[model samples]
Target chain A: MTFVIMFLEFFKTGLFAIGGGLATLPFLYDMAAKYPWFNEAILSDMIAISESTPGPIGINMATYAGYHVGSQYFGIPGGIFGAILTTTALVLPSLIVILIIAKFLERFKTNQFVKDAFYGLRPAVTALIAYAGYQVVAESLFRFSTFFETMQIGDLFVWNAIILFIVLMVLSRVFKKIHPAAWIGIAAVVGILLKF
Target chain B: MRLLWDLFFTFFRIGGLTFGGGYAMLPMLQNELVEKRKWTTEEELLDYYAVGQCTPGIIAVNTATFVGQKIKGFWGAVFATAGVVFPSLVIISIIAGFIQNFSHLEWVQHAFAGIRVAVAVLVVNAVLKLWKSGIKDILGIIIFIVTFVVSAVFSLSPVFVVIAAILVGILAGQVKRRTKK
Candidate 1:
């Protein structure tokens, strides 16, 4: 039953989370609301870990959720199975779509309607990404202040994160030739050392 | 065996190092897979990205799966996905356990506070970049604003918003087609 559920949930995520992994958030939120196995807090952690880690955020979250839920429900085998099932289900949609698209690449390249459609899709994708970013910021920065009356408006700003952002932005520009891995490494060390 | 290891290690490194999620991983992915390894050419990677964007799931994972399957087979896909997920699974689990204990600790809270601001900036940067890349024309800009306002203000389900936008876009395209004719 758990396996079935894991497969189905991930399948749905794969089927509709177009525009990429961050777009998976809204669906994952809905899943949390429907299922007792996960919650928003866990989703928050998933975002953090997913962003910091690699592959895809959606796949990573699915794996995390599967393992967490599966371990709770059954045991190690359940966890492993859940992880496998979730990853498989998540990738399945893209695999199928890619195969189909691959067959039609030449045709698609110059099709005005298809081009226009993609042109439309581009902004929608950007909006989706923005929304995902907003959600993360809201949870991490603003949610804390709402809990207490004494919390200042300034408390919600997260200066360290802002500083890191400025630093990264500047670094990205200054070191255009540098690899992203170097930036990530620097951020990770900074995160640990500054403990932010 | 070496093939599988390469598939796994590549994705594992990708998963382990990147921050700011899927889109942020794009340049890195292009660099590693397309430029560095030359496993997939630039054109192939772009096509993979396009398809990956249109399909469900994370673009990074989808790309990994596609490349993995292309390079090897079923086992390649398996190892690649595993590699991509392994880092997050370990990291999140450890954080979860620690959070259980120090969730309320002041310094920890302060740290997250700082991280939150950084996250917002990262998100803004992502949005700006996407806006430049995607919004090619006035119509695209209008569509973006309308979608953002509708979705953000009303808290509409993104699925419905996407559907509505598609329908509207198709209608607009038809109108333009008739005008051109």
Candidate 2:
């Protein structure tokens, strides 16, 4: 039952997550809120790992989410199964839609409805992704749970996270040639070295 | 059989090597598909990419499917897609299985914390890029602002937000056509 729901959820993500892999972030955020499979902290980790890994970010995230959800319910074997199911579910819609488009490539490309719909969707998808980014930044840099407990101003921020975030953001702009995976690798080493 | 196998291996190589996302995969696709094997011309590949972008789901997967269907029909599309996603399924599953065991470690926790910050930064960078490309006119800006506030402040489902945007977009397009006449 859980696996079935997982498949449906991922299929929906695959169906609607237009634009690219990053576009899928909003859906993943929604899943984190709705399911016990993952949380914001884990979703952050998933994003890091997915971005650094091979293959597409959207598919990697689906597999990762599937594994986490399945493992919690059934164990390692379940995780592997979940990974396959979720990945397939995510890819299934693309396969169907692309095949259909391939047959009518010319007609579809010139269709005004497709163009206009995408025009509106592009901005909305960007906004959705931006919101997802905000949630991630908050999860990483703010001590929300701790703040709730302590109810103090000092307790509300993860100062190290904030500093690192700013530094990395600047470095990313300055060194535009570097791959994101490299920056992530640098951060991991810095984390260990600084005991962050 | 040979062409199907070639299609699968070609995409598998492309998928395993390329990092970041669909755009990052382009130079590689040009090299492998257009330049090396002559499976497609540069123009056709670009068209596939453009169509893939506006379509739902991952762009890379959509491109692979389009190319495969063009080459060897349905089975080609199947194999290519399967090959492309195979590496992710294997690599991520193994990592997922192992990472949970080590997640409780102090050093691992620290590393993840740092990675988390970097992830946020990367996501913000992506949003900026999207903004430049996606937000074009007044309608686009309005849609962006409304979608962001609705989802961010009110915490509405992104699905609803996306659905509403599509409807509004089509309606706006129709309205513009009528006014121009």
Candidate 3:
């Protein structure tokens, strides 16, 4: 049952996540809401792990989610099976789509509608990507209790996140040539050094 | 056999080291895959990137898979996917083991605070690059704005938004055809 559920969830992820890994966030959020297996906090952790690790963020998250849910519901075999199910299901749609697209690429290279549709789809993709970023901010920075608090204009702000955001942005701009890995590495070290 | 192993190891190293996801992997991929190994040309890498974006799956994995397939057929994709995933599986397993405690650490949270901002910037850079590459004309601009506003404001499902855009695009094409006739 867990295997089947994992397969179906990832199949949907593959079929509909048009823009790629980042695009899968919204779906994962929805999944969190729908399934009792994981919650938003775990999803956020998944995002962090997925971002820091290799492979597609979506695949890693799916694998993580499968492992968590399957292990909890069934056992070790269930977790492994769930991971396999999600990975195969997640890539299956792309495999099929790419094969079909590959076959017709030459014929459709100059097709105006195909070109235009893709062109139009680009912005939508951008928007989806932006929304993913925003969701991350909302989750990390804003809290429901803060919202409910006496509408204190000053209390509404999360100064720590905002400050860190500004500092990182400045560092990125100032050290434009430095690889992002360096920054992430530094941050991780800082995390450990500061005992965060 | 060595070549396949090299390919696998190279990608595994890439997958292990890269943080901030696919876009962050771009320069590293170019450096390792194109510059060092000469596995594929720059133009081919760009083409792979484009295809990776349009298709499903993570761009990094899609790219690794495509490159792997190009280099060694089915086994290439298999190896590349494994290479890309191996690091995360190991790291995440370790992290997962200690994550319950790790989350409560103040410095860890602070570091995440900084990392989160970096992630935002990376996403912004990605968005800007995509916008430049993608939005070319008036119709393209309209589609972008419409999609952005609709999704950002209303929080609609991207699948539905994409479907609608395709429908509108096809309709526009048909209208143009009729007018030309």
Candidate with maximal DockQ = 2
Could you tell me which residue pairs clash in candidate 2? none
Residue pairs clashing, model 1: A53-B15, A54-B15, A55-B15, A161-B114, A161-B118
User: Which stretches of candidate 1 lie above 4 Å from their native place?
Assistant: A1-82, A101-107, A134-156, A191-196, B1-9, B19-56, B63-83, B89-126, B164-181
List candidate 3 stretches off by more than 4 Å.
A1-58, A61-93, A137-148, A189-196, B1-76, B95-106, B171-181
Share of reference contacts found in each model: 0.47, 0.77, 0.44
**lDDT per residue as tens, model 1, A1-196:** 7678878888988888877767888989998999876899878866655544444667767777776777776676667666666767877776666555544754576877666555556676666667767776666545465546657777666566666777777777686567666665565556657877
Residue A34's lDDT in candidate 1: 93
Docking class of 2: acceptable
* iRMSD for each candidate structure, in the order shown: 4.9, 6.0, 4.8
lDDT of 3 by residue, A1-196 (tens): 6567768888999888876678888988998999886799988877766654555677777777766766676676666655656666777777566545544644685788776566556655555655666665665455547767777777666666566556666887797666555666665665455443
RMSD of each: 5.6, 7.5, 5.9
Deviation from native of the Cα of residue A2 in model 1, angstroms: 7.4
Could you give the TM-score of chain B for each candidate, in order?
0.64, 0.57, 0.68
* Model 1 chain A poorest 10 in a row by lDDT: A47-56
